[model samples]
Target: MENLGVGKVLLVEDDERLAALIAHFLTQHGFEVRAVHRGDVALAAFLEFKPRVVVLDLMLPGQSGLHVCREIRAISDIPIVILTAKEDDLDHILGLESGADDYVIKPIKPPVLLARLRALQRRQVPQDSVRGALEFGRLVIDRSCREVRLGAQVIDLTTMEFELLWLLASAAGTLLSRDDILNRMRGIAFDGLNRSVDVYISKLRGKLNDNPREPVCIKTIWGKGYLFNPFAWEV
Candidate 1:
């Protein structure tokens, strides 16, 4: 594979051999990769490198990958795909809760990892349908700038969160099932167990200032899916 020059990728892995191999593979597949072997310095490297995305390992020398993920997310919404060695459900949920955009369980398949990275990138790409800014009362969604503003305040959202919001808001009152959302956003069929959509929806609700207990804007349809009520955005 030749480098398509898609974007820069920051890889944080302790193992020298694995890091080198991952870097090489990503570089060949159109990414400029910078491999870092320490979690403590990952943030510094991220700030300096300003990569489009991050590939992080769970275990590190000093700082844990979860801590690194939280720190990175505090400043920027740069996409983070954590590499977790454990297949435990708690580990997976905790990684997402730590602000990681996605997680990959090792031993890693380079192609699968690459696909996940590309999916993250796709969320950042603007769509033709969202030509101009969308306004619902005080809420403003600007597709061109990929920004969402509530009243006078700017809401910070990860790439995935923003994409999910846009998809639902565009449909307004329509109910979007989990399978429907997965297919549209990820270009893949849902296996009925992928909770990425639900996780991101929670994150989006938090950022959007929607009440979790009595959510008015983005509401869950119980067994159906999710619904974005445009009218609920009003004061």
Candidate 2:
């Protein structure tokens, strides 16, 4: 097992036994783990603990996990991983749509969860290959600060949204297929049925104020891929 080094993690789980087990396992792997047993208090814990990553469960008391996820996303772009026993596609979609960066179907294997957490940590490090900031007319994406601004107004993007936008903007005007996006962002190949990429694209479009029906910023080249129009932000 590769030591992931010390990092703070917030675990939101209603099940006491599961939370304790997970917290213990992660602590053993050098993580400072804080466990919260209710969804309503999850945000408070998150604010106080300032965890680098959040492991959230859907079936939570006091509030739904999706609600907590959205609350956290509104204020921070910190990585969130949904750990739930629900295996349905709808549950997965809802989790991702609510701002989670990763989803793990549970009957928890500590090693697998640890691996996912490690991956999230790796993603936080700035990419040395990409430029520090990308400016397109009124839109600016600052990789150094992980900030995006449209004109004078700062845009609030979830972690996944920002990453997806950065990926597209970096390869402006080029068509990146769904398979390409899935592999690049999630480390998984598109199975023809997976819609995670589309979900994030929709989210990016909404935040960027691009009309989905006739988007100018992120254009859909049907049956092929997506293209980022670098010249469309002038308005």
Candidate 3:
């Protein structure tokens, strides 16, 4: 973990005591941390630190977590993981929708948080320098920037949307089973209810202008799963 190079981290928590503890824990784990209570100061510190990642608390004195998340996303694509006291599925999903790369419920142990942050930082690092962006006709996916473009149209996608689309595009024309997708998207033992993945798929299809009735890109493989038709880019 020491080789991770003490990446910069910004923590926005109103609880001063808890903030000190979290800051200490993160520093011990090789992360340079700046903990702030106000969103305004946090934003300023973020620019100064130019952190590789952020740990944002939903409850803030100056700005709501959602507001901060949106503002951060407007300027950059730095991966953000929102901390929330509520464990409701909808709340977590909303967090994802609001540009958060991940969500962690309260009562998280220090080790768990450290592990998740490290994982995120690892993913954020550039894995390929020479590999060209993925191009399927109008849909352009820049692997380096993590951005999507349809023809001349720039599109915004949630984290889950991006992940699902990336998986399908990477394996175009290959059928991926629903269970496999669920595990990959959520986890091997994800406990989400039945309609969660389905809902997300529906939403993604809408963004891609994919018609279920006369499907173009994503097609159902009957009882199997979904496949991204590589040939759709032509028609």
- In candidate 1, which residue ranges exceed 4 Å CA deviation? 1-6, 126-130
Tens-digit lDDT string for candidate 2 (2-50): 1222489999999999999999999999999999999999999888888
User: What C-alpha lDDT do the candidate models reach, one value each?
Assistant: 0.85, 0.88, 0.75
Tens-place lDDT per residue, model 3, 117-209, is: 876665555535525577888788776666788877777775456767887888898998778776666553345444445556776788778
In candidate 1, where is summed lDDT lowest over 10 consecutive residues? Answer: 1-10
Top-down TM-score ranking: 1, 2, 3
Q: Write the per-residue lDDT of candidate 1 for residues 177-216, one digit (tens) a residue.
A: 9999988877777676677788888888888888988888
Question: What is the Cα-based lDDT of residue 66 in candidate 1?
Answer: 94
Compared with the true structure, model 3 gives a TM-score of: 0.79
| Minimal lDDT window, size 10, model 2 | 1-10
Number of the top-ranking candidate, with TM-score as the measure: 1
Query: Model 2: which residue pairs collide?
Result: none
Candidate 2 wrongly placed segments (more than 4 Å): 1-6, 126-131
